[model samples]
Every structure is written in C-alpha cells, then in structure tokens.
Target chain A: MKVASGLLAFVLMFSSQAYARQTFEVDLQLEARVYTENALQSEQKDASLSLAVTPEWYRDWQGGAHSITVTPFARVDSADDERTHGDIRELHWQGVLGQWEILVGISRVFWGRTELLHLVDTINQDDALENLDGEDKLGQPMLRINYVADNGSSTRLFVLPYFRERAFPGEEGRLRPPLPVDDNDPLYQSGAEEKHVDWALRHQGWVGALDYGVAWFSGNQRDPKLVPGSVVPVMTPVGPRLQVQSLRPFYGLMDQFSVDAQYTAGDWLFKLEALWRDEFNSVATALNPAIERRDDYSAASLGFERTFYGVSGNASDIGVLAEYLWDERGDEGSGFQNDLFVGARWAANDVAGTALLAGVVVDLEEYSQFYSVEFSRRIGSASKLSVEARAFHDVPPEDRSFFLVRRDGYLQLEYNLYF
Target chain B: MNHPRRKINVLAAILLSLVAGTSLAQYDGLSAEDKGLAIAREADRRDLGWGDSSATMNMVLRNRQGDESVREMRNKALEVADDGDKSLIIFDEPRDVRGTALLTFSHRVGDDDQWLYLPALKRVKRIASSNKSGPFMGSEFAYEDISSQEVEKYTYRYLRDETLNGQDCFVIERDPVDEDSGYSRQIVWMDKAEYRVQKVEYYDRKDSHLKTLTFHDYQQYLNKHWRAQRLEMVNHQTMKSTTLTFADYTFANGFDDREFNQSGLARMR
Candidate 1:
C-alpha cells in the first residue's frame, strides 16, 4: 500500500510540472546457484534462484541546472519452499541552488573507496549486506546538505533515522521461525522499533597526482525484542522454554572512523586504507555472554597495480593487495589475521572493443581461494556483453573441502542509449 | 646650336620613359572610388579558379582570451555552364560529415540561396536568417562570410593604401546589405601580387571593432591558385580566436551535381 501511494504521488507531481524533463532507467538481473557439501550431516545440495529489478527516474527543472532523482528498487527470492521480498530502496530528492545542494529521503550515499570490494560501507546497512551474505536492506532515509568551498572542495552532513529486522535468537533450530507476533497480543500491537542518529564528516585532498580522503562517523544502535515468538529455545534444563528472559532491546553508541588514499601515475596505481571502530556491537556477541565485547577493531589494506605492454601488441594489467584484520573476538585472546590477493587482466589492444579479465582472491586466515574469468565484447556503438565463471575452494585439504567448494558463474549483457 | 638644344629635350623625354617602365613594378595607391571599383571588378571576375580547384581550407577562431579552435574543411567545386553564378561544394572527409554537400546560387543584388545537406538529419536545410551572422560552429568565421562573395551583396569603398606586415596592400571597406548582419562594415587588406586577402577587421553593427582575421603561410597551387594555408580570426568582444590548417589539396576532381544532392548525403558511408 505504501509503495502504491508513493508511486501515485510521484506520477502526479511529475505530471503537474509545465516543462518537466524526465528520464527513466531500469536494470534487471537473474541468478541461479547450487551449493554442495562433502559432510554427511550437512545438506547434500541446495539450489536457489533470485531476481532483482531497479527503476530510477530523474526530473530536471530550470534548464537542467537543478534536478531530482528517485530510484525505487526491489528484489525477490524463492528456493526450497522459502520466499523473501522487500522494498527498502532509494527514494530521494536533491535540490541545487547555486553552489549549495540539499538531499532528503531514503538514499544510498557512497563515501570513501573500496566500492568494488566494500569494507568501509557500514553506516546504515547490516554487516551481512556489506559482505553479500544475502538479500539485505537496500537503503535508509536521511537528510543531507552539501556546501562547496571556493577551493573546489565540498563538505556534507547527514541526519538519518531508519529500521531493519533480523532473525530472532535461537530461531535457527526450527525449520521456519514462527511469526514475530500472534496478531492479537497487546504487546505485539506495533512492529519492532529501532531508531538511530548518525553523523559523518569527510574531507578530500590531492596528494600529488593521487586523490585521497578521510571519513569519520558515529551512530547509535538499538534493537528491541517486542514479539513473544521471536525467541526460541536452544538449551533447556527441564522442558523447552522461551530462550529469551527479557524483551528489552540492547542499546549502545558506536563510533567508526577510517582514512584512505589513492594515487594513479603513468601506468601504476596505488591505494591504501586503515579503519578503526570503538566498542563494536554484535548481536551474536550479546547473545553469548561468554564472548567478551571487543573494545577496538582495526583493519588496514594496501594495493599496487601496474600495466604492461606485451610484445604481441596486447595490454596486460596486474595488481596485488595485502590486508590485515584484527578483532578482540578471536579465539586466541587477541584477534589478529592477515590476507593476501593477486590478480591479472589481459586485453588485445588492436581489437576495437574487446577485452578479457581474470583474477583470483585468497584469504590466508581462512585458507580459502576464489578464481574467476570473464570475457567482454562490444556489440555495437552503445552495447556490450560479457560472460564470467568463478570457483571457490578451501585449500590444504582441497578434496575434503565442504562449504567452500562451489562453482559460481554469471553472464551479463548491457547496452546504453545516450542522448 | 638651336638644333642641339631641341635634341637634348627629346633625349630627356626618352630617359624619363625608360625610368617609368622600370619603376612601374611598384604598386600605386588607388582613389576611394577606384578601390571600390577594383573590388567590384574582382568580384565580377569569372575566372577565380575556385570552381575547378580541389582545395582544403583551415579556419581558426580565437577569442579575446587567447584560446584558439581550428576547423579544416575540403572543397571540390565546379562552375555550372561557365555562368559563374552557381556552384556546388562537396566534403569528402570527417566521416560524420562526409558526402555532405553545399550549393550556392549567387545573385547580383540579394541574399543567395544557400542550402546545406545535414547527414544526421538526412535533410537539406536552408540556413535560417538569424544564424547567418553567427559564427560557424563557434569559430571566428561567420556563415555568411564563408558563402560566395558577390558584388551586389555588399557596398564597398576603397579606404587607403597601407603597408601591413611590410606588404603594401589595398584596403577596402564593405558594408553588407542584410540589416541583420552582426557587422556594420569590414575592412579588408588585399595583397597586391595575387589580390588574396591578407587581413580583415570586422566592425559590429554599432560600428565597434569586433574581430580581426590574419592570413599567413601563402601556398601557390597550380601556379595560378594562391591560397593561405593558415587563417586566424580573433573575436575582440569574446576574447576568443581559432586557427585553421589546410592540407591534401587536389584540383579539378570532376565533382558532379549528383554528389551534392540530398539523397547522396544519406548514402555516405
């Protein structure tokens, strides 16, 4: 009902404008994956199919000097008698007045580097979404303002309040978790409420030929257990009873900060970033009292990339990145870990618009590796198609690998029409 | 003794004729009326050789800020039945604009019927009147300035003979008949040897100096065709200028009328 109302209001608002210039764009994707394990106890194999669609609209007024864009996106998944769907996407409007700009509504604001391999994109969404654990919350509503300085730098501030729902504690024991409420209980009169207030500041500067920035943000976290059936039993002394003793939400204030720098000179590029979080909050840690709360979590990574001209008139680019992650939650008292990855890409320079890309990623701490290969070719002036295949494996005892041994593949065909 | 005195007078007259013949190589300044007459006569000349020559021209437009942009265009044109009043221009390079055509029908006293084939639009559009005086692709050269120059299109007056860059040139002032023309009058400095324009100063309709064009690097083709390889125009009001470079010039390629038709534009590869 809310989605329908929002769509209707948007259409009416757009139709009322006298000289409105609007652009609509849509992107659709489908993927099927199969997972297998060697262990007898674990499920032999599982398959799932997913679909996602994103539609975006932009309206311009006053000769394109000022414009507003909204993207209402959705995703659906059905596998093994389980279904999930949601509508937590972008719905925002931006106004530009001279050198000042303001944005209001639910939107995804990307800051800092590592958009390709996101490690610092952890403001409003869950950690699972950042790690691509599953289809997670899409975006959050926020009010943001930006001011451009005379020296070509800009400062932005945001105020956001949003909500999300997660699996109840001990619900993994059941085939399907019970509904949050019975629909008639007085305590279940309203849905679970979680509110947050976050503030972040970022500054960008040029270090010779490289662009760099530093960002810092602090926010509040609260998740209340308002539903009676949300908590199930894991360990029962007598008969099975509700695992949750209290329905109060865990509340805390969390601060996250990071600094990053990148430079591209000639055929070589370098990137580096370091992040630190104080008093990291985790529901798993909160549920298990034996797991101590981590006071500080720090991670740092560095990457180097270089392009080589092959004798066969082909161009090849190779890059390597080394990263270290530390969390106090590790088993051996102090959490310390390191990972290294190296990748290479080759393309025929003489070809009009054709290239081949392949890479491998390795996690030293987990002793796991993933390899992928992709080929792309330009179809015409404004179209392109690509096919890719990837395989994940656990090293050391590769044959005995269980959850990490899988072949994942995807193919994408895209075309752009410009005016 | 009286006969000898008369012989001395004749001998002096002969010496004077010999000196006059030798010194006649130097250009003599023309009166205001004669200057206008010479420009009119040059415009009326039926054998400028443009109709038979395959030539490339590079035009540069410069703003007051010292920035320069260049545009190179090739022309293959031919006279129609020696009438000297009609001709067709065909462009062969710059793939997007290749096979595009332009036809000019010069008249004795009014605006010419100038038509251009737009490849993208696949149509022939008669240039609008308001755009006639505007810069051609934001260059220093206006569309009307590049069209065929006819005697009746402008009223000319010989200014004064002046030496520009050490070359003695004939300066002529011309005022366009079109009231909407951005320029009120233009002063052209023509070289004496080939009558090729060496420099031009444009005055806005308000009579304010708006721009100046300087032509250099003269290359003589086919012994009789003298063309400037570089022409730079600077807009004083806009502080902008452009430079043009010409190359790959061929003469008399037998360009046909069919190549300039609207249908030919769509068939361009």
Candidate 2:
C-alpha cells in the first residue's frame, strides 16, 4: 500500500509539471502473461499482469540555444495466482545538456549486441519484487556521463556504487529454500543491500561508414556458493535447509571488456561484437571455496539489418543476428551456446498510420525458441495504441528423446500521448 | 472593293511595323557591357517588393560513393523590407519549424548580420559570423547564397554574347569583394529580351567548378516583373541537387518591420 501511494504521488507530481509545459509526452503499458512450464509441480495455468507509466516534460530556453527535458516513470505488477498485490517499481530521472547527457536514478541499461542473449549478465532481478533485483548486491545508484567529440564521435563513462540482495524476513510461508544466514554473514539482513562500486568507460568512433566502440568495466561481483548436503537449522518446516554461502564484501576486481562495430551504407547495416568477462553464472558462484579460481568467459555476436523503401515513402526493415557464448563453468570443458534470431519491421505513413513487427529466435544449444509479434496504430494527433504478443518454448534435440514442455507467453497493450 | 481593302490592310501593317521598330530601337543599340549593367539594375529594382510566396524545396544529398538521400520541405516566406540594407523573413509551415523568424541586415559590400528565432527553444540566437558558407539545413543553399543581390556586392564584366536555351543572352562574370563568400566569382547568362536569369555557374576560390543553378518556367507578374516558378541547383563536388518550386505570390502586402521582431516570433503560432 505504501508503494502504491508513493508511485501515485510521483506520477501526479510529474504529470502536473508536464501539463504546465507546452511540450509533454506520456506512455502507458499494460501486460498480461500466462505461464505453463515443467518447473510447476501442479501443471496448473498461472496468470500475471503489469502496468507501467512514463511521462516527459520539455522546455526550450535561451532563445533556442538549448533545450531541457525531464522524464519520470513508474510501474506496478500483480501475479502469484492473482491473489496478491504487485510490487511498485522505482522512479527514474534523465537529463540532457547540449551535446552532453546524464542519466540518474534506477533504470534498465540495455547494452551489448547479442540477439535474444545477454553476454554481460552483471545484473539480475528478483522474481517476486517487480522492480527490485533480489540477487543484486547493490541497489541502482548509478551516474552516467557522456562527451561528444568534434568529428561527431562520443565517449561515455558510468559509475555505480552498490549491489542489491534479497533475504527472507521470517521462516514461515517461504517460496523457496533460504540461504544460510549466520551472524557473520555479510548479506544477512533482508530486502536489498548495497555492497560495492562498479565503474565502466566506453569510447565510440566512426571510421568511414562504420561505427565502432570499445567498453570496459570493473565492479563488485556476486559470489554464490552451493554447499552439498550441508543442511542448516533455520527452524522451519516443509522448506528444505539449503546451505547457501554468501561471501563477505571482499575487495576484488571483476571486469568486462567488449568491442562492437557496425556499418550502415544505404539501406544495409552489419554489426559484430565480442565480449569477455571474468566469471560464469553469478559472480558470486566464483567465490565458492571448492572452485574459486576459474573465471574466464567470452561471447561474440554478429547481425545484419536491411531496409526497403516503398513508393509512398514508407519503409520495411529486416534484421538477423547470430550469437555464440563460451562458458568454462558449464559441464565438460565448456558449454558452447548459440542463438539465431530474425525479425521484420514495417512502417507505413498511409491514412491508417500502422506499424507491424515480428521476430523469431532459436536457441540451438538449449533447444529453445521464442516468437514475438507487435502492431501499432496512431489514433489521433497525440495518441497511439499498440498490441504485442510473445511466446517461448523448449525443444529436444532428438525426436526420440523426452523434452521439457516449457511454455511462457504474454500479451501487452500500450498507449502513448504526445504533446 | 478588293483593291480598297488591300490598301487599307497594307497601311495598317506599315503602321504596326513602325511602332515595333521604335520600341525595339530603345534597347538594341546598347553595348554588351551596358546591357549587362542594365539587367543587374533591373533585377535590383523589380525584386524590391513586400511580397509573400510559398515554395516547395527538394534536396538530394549524395556522398562520394554515389549514394543519395532525398528530402523535401515546404516553405512560406514574407519579404517585409528591401531597403538594400535590411530585410525581414518569416516562415510559417512544417509544424515542427513553424513560428521561426529570420532578420537579415545586409551591407552593400560587407558582411550581413543574421538572427534566427527558434520557437522550440524560445531563443533568438545570433548565427556565428564564420558559418556563412555552411549549407542551409544541409541543403545545397548556403547561408550566404540566398541573400538579396545588391549592385555593389559584386563587380560585373560582360564576358560575351551567347545563345542560351535558344535565346540570345549576355554572359556576365561577377567577382565578389567579400572575402567570406564561398565563391570567388560567378558567371551568369541573362536573356537579353526578357532580362531573366537563365543560368549561373559558380567558381570556388581556386576557380574550380562548384555549382550551377538553372531557372525556368518564367511567368510575368503585375505586368512589370518576371518570376521563375522553378529553380534547380546542383552541386558538382557533392553531386547533390536541389529543386525549388514557387507559387502563390501576393505582392505589396502591408507588412511592418515591427512584425519581424524577436517578441513577434513567439506569437507567430
């Protein structure tokens, strides 16, 4: 209830400010999902719902010499058999100064170039806490700065201090096994806890028609250790005692270095990237006493995009991407995973004002597939509506082998208003 | 009866020829240099008017690889004053660019002061002095390219007489005294009879071919002025081109200088 009230107040305040400005924009999204996976014991269908709202305000000043814009956003979701209320998301603020830009507060930073895959798995979110990351050792307190060069090139740097972790408040009504928590445990207290600072630097440049960038980061890592058969006395029934060791806040350096390049000529664009990281799974997994020294990982991705313009100035774009990851932490020498994805997007400026997009992703190593489709229409001068659907399934490599039936799908509806 | 009618017709024909000869004699005897000077003077006189016109501009931007992208824009302009030193221009279209205003103070043979009002930023920024040669909105038109042509801005010398587009024209070469101008000199071909600009070739500081502009589809307005409804400019180095289509000309509009002020820009919407 407090989260709901706080989110409501934030929205109202920002919305009023946006209304005062002649330039304003708002985007609202509502999503519904149905899950049918083998991980569920009862073979029952579960439904989940979520809502997100974002509002922006802009004003030009100094005789048009510069412009200022502000955006505040929030979200709410409900799941768990539709009986419990959803958690409220955090608020975020973003500002731009001429050619320079800055982003503060809590927001998702989607970097990297893997198709339907993520190479830099630095942050993990909590399942039950909609906006919070239960596994993260740091809450989202980050500062990002960027500088533009004379030749239309740019560089950016980011500094984030802390990590977030989730802990059970009590022993009753536990959804899963609780981590072993003693008085000496560093992350014993509950909810979200901050740990250490993470920093990164990136430089982007253009060589002829190709755009390229290299980024590097050093940060606090998550170290999760699994103790075999070492049950602890948490004083709870029905739930198993899982001895999960959480390493203390140690002074260590976990780094990720990457290089990305893309070239766009006419209607065709090609991109490629390679990422190297220090650990596999969670950074915490590397801290286990049994195997704490093995920490080398790498991933690479390549993609191609093309666009076709129609007679009426409308355009259609198609893109395909392939990604591969080498994880030394997997079974045998290392697990090699690959994902292939293809997408098609259409934009038309006819009377109907319609846009459509569809995509398919196939995970070759895991034998999983994901499909998505979306359509949008402009309803009025400042209003638009969109609908989207996504489906995921797991397939077995051989026909004679038994396959896990993992089916997760969702339907989303969104409305946007611009001024 | 047939003889009398024939004599009457012959006399009328002779009278009409005498009148045509007298009118033609006024301008035909002038030297080529004087003819060139006369064309420039006529342009200065007729172009000075408070008029509003709408134009559709098209630009084709080509790179070294021969790749191209085309962009189109519609413009509405009001020329408020033409005192040879100052002019005010107001544009009102392309909702994103509406409410924008420009004030230009032109000197006879010196640099011009240009101020632009951007409604989105609510600020009237004075354009830097060094950017006069930069392309206007990434188009072939440069900041210094579209200013009013004053007689003193350039020194003209008649090159020769030439047939341009099947019409006899006087080719004049003009050298600009302003050091900031992107072009050192320009060669212009004007129709001797109509005083209309048929073609112009621009030469860079190194005397290299920079661009060419061709005017066509001339229409007489108010019985005193001829305006071309279509103009095409092609940049040789960039391999880019721009086409301008003009229409809806309203002459002698009662526009005041105060209407082009910075405060007035905010109220344009």
**Which CAPRI quality tier does the interface of model 1 achieve?**
incorrect
lDDT of 1 by residue, A201-258 (tens): 7665443345566777766532222323245567667877657533333334557787
TM-score of every candidate relative to the true structure: 0.48, 0.48
Q: How well is candidate 1 docked (DockQ)?
A: 0.02
lDDT of 2 by residue, B1-269 (tens): 35998899879767975865223334466776575566677666655553644444554554456554444443434553434444545543222233466766565645555556664334443433333454554456666666767777777777788998899987898877677677889999988676678999999878999889999899876676787877788889767676666666545544443334333332232
lDDT of 2 at A240: 48
Span of ten consecutive residues with least summed lDDT in model 2 chain B = B260-269
What value does DockQ give for candidate 2?
A: 0.03
lDDT of 1 by residue, B1-269 (tens): 36997899778767875865322222247656666766556634523655555556665544455544334455555554444355455553222234366755555554454546653223343322233564454456776666666666677888877898889877889888777566799998886545778998999867999888888898877665776777777778766667766667666665555433322222222
Off by over 4 Å in 1: A1-20, A34-45, A78-84, A114-116, A124-137, A163-193, A220-252, A280-294, A309-311, A314-336, A347-356, A374-385, A395-419, B1-269
TM-score of candidate 1 versus the correct structure, residues matched by position: 0.48
**Model 1 local distance difference test score:** 0.52
**Chain B TM-score for candidate 2:** 0.75
Candidate 2 docking: what grade?
A: incorrect
